[model samples]
Target: MIPIAKPYLTAEDAQAAYDTILTGWITQGPRVQEFEEKFAAYTGAKYAVAVSNCTTALHLSMIVAGIGEGDEVICPSMSYIATANSIKYVGATPVFAEVNQEYNLDPTDVEKRINSNTKAILLVHQIGMPADIDAIKKICSRYNLKLIEDAACAVGSAYKGQKIGSHSELVCFSFHPRKIISTGDGGMITTSRKDYYDRLRLLRQHGMSINDRVRHNSKKVIFEDHIEVGYNYRMTDIQASVGIKQLEKLDWIVTERRKIANKYHEALKNIEGIRLPLERERYFSNYQSYSIYLEKSFPINRNRFMQELLDNEIATRRGIMNSHRETAYKHLEDKVNLPVSEKLQDRSVLLPLYVPMIEEDVKFIIDTILKLTQLKTV
Candidate 1:
């Protein structure tokens, strides 16, 4: 069956990994530092810290931002659990906020949820499409709230000509196999604040005053003390080797994904009872996952449509989970009604999308969807 997502790796990545292994500096070393520097340059951020995964990156961001017990982090209900899990990791409450049709946090709803307990707004660029960050940033600025961008799906995405990671005080990225870029399993945090950058660097490596890489290169064999409690979330040099190669091809990979998205948009635009993904003006999406919403009038329910696609050798996925409904967060009082988020959860489905997928594959998926829609009308 066709997979919902796939990672594109070439010999370049393999060679880089081999070189790192031969050097015997596999743990967080020169390669990791190089990856961080390259990633920061690509996103135009002053600093980037590589970690084990996006979850850890988010957790580090929270710790650096001083979000802790009793502090409420406003986040969209419709997002991957990692976004909410990070808040819990820091002993903070994640307050649910409504989403717009774009499946992004509604700035208006976010503003209403802001209270004295609220410390930050954690916004996800869902499915590679950018959130209404300009408006969200305004809300954060007005209330002096810290803005954390869970940009796991938006590696090459941009808003108003600025990269996604550049806008927020702290932005988290993922390089999972299914993501636009892959380093096996890794994450990075980008920020302009020097203190936050330093804090993240320290927090990712067990709060060590000096990292092992620095000590290894030093003539002295003396070790350092732990400054604060931190986790062992450092990314290995081997993984960073792969990441450096992936970074080189990021733009080309994003271009291919966009081409596939455009093909879907062109083919599905005329189909009735289907809402295609939207590309807001001045925004550029990586199209990491091509998601479409089945309209209420569509004769076939989302589950049935997904099943049919799967039966026809096409794979699909439900949209990101509603964090408020998860067992972890159910106990918290959900004061806000996220109608849009709930509706999206029911109707949204992700289509097969990745680099190297031929044009014919896109057409085939579109045709299958259109045929299914037509059959339901009979």
Candidate 2:
């Protein structure tokens, strides 16, 4: 069966891994530093901190931003649970907010959620489609709130002529195999602020004044100190080696995926009771995930539709998630109604858009969906 998502790895990627292993410095050493530099240069970020994964990246973003206990961070519930969990990692409350037609955090709803205790807005570029960054940035500036971007699936995505990482103050990215880029399981935090860049660098490596690589490279014996309590969230040279290669292919991957996305749009646009993902003007999505929304008027239910796709040998997945409905965030749930977010979680399906899918694969998936939607076609 066709997969909903898969990593686009080449023999070169495997070779990079092997080369790093041969170097005998597989920890967060030269390769990790090199990957950080390349990623920062690519994203226009002044510095990029490589980490274990996106969740840890988010956690670090929160810590460096001064989000802590008694503070509330506004984020859309229609996202990966990691988005909300990151806020909690800093002992900050995550207040659920609604999303717009673009499936991004709605600025209007976010404004209403902002109380005296609100510290930041964790905006997500959900599934590689950028959120309304301008509107949200305006809100942050007006209220003096921190703006952190959960850019997990948006490695190669852009917004308003700028890349997603360069647009936000603190942007967290994922390199999970399921994401646009694969580092096996790695993440990066991009920021233009020198202060944040320094703090994150110190915090990610156990808050040590001197890093292991620096100590080992010293001609004479050197001492180190733990400046503050920090987590072991460093990315390995092995993962960074693979990430470097993945980064090289990012632009081409995005171009090819956009072509596939266009095909899906063309094939599915005419179907009744369906809502398609939108690319806002100047917001270039990488289509990290191609999710389809079955309107209430659609003939089939979401589960049954997915089942039918599986029966037809096409694998599909549900939309991101609704954190409020999950047991993990039960205490965070509130009376505030997130209608758009709820509807999106319940009605959306993620179709296979992995690299290497042929035109025939795209057509087959489209034809099946059209049939499921009860549209007439040959």
Local distance difference test, candidate 1? 0.91
lDDT of each: 0.91, 0.91
lDDT of 1 by residue, 1-378 (tens): 778999999999999999999999999999999999999999999999999999999999999998999999999879988999999998998888888888888888899998999999999999999998889889988999999999999999999998888987899999999899999999999999999999899989889998887888799787899999889999999999999999999999999999899888888887777898888899899999998998878879899999999999999999778977888777653565777888898898999998799767777888898889766533
**The 10-residue segment with the lowest total lDDT in model 2:** 369-378
Model 1 misplacement above 4 A: 332-336
lDDT of 2 by residue, 253-370 (tens): 9999999999999888878877889997898999999988988788888888899899999999997789988999776567658888888988998989988789888999988987
lDDT score of model 2? Answer: 0.91
Clashes of each: 0, 0
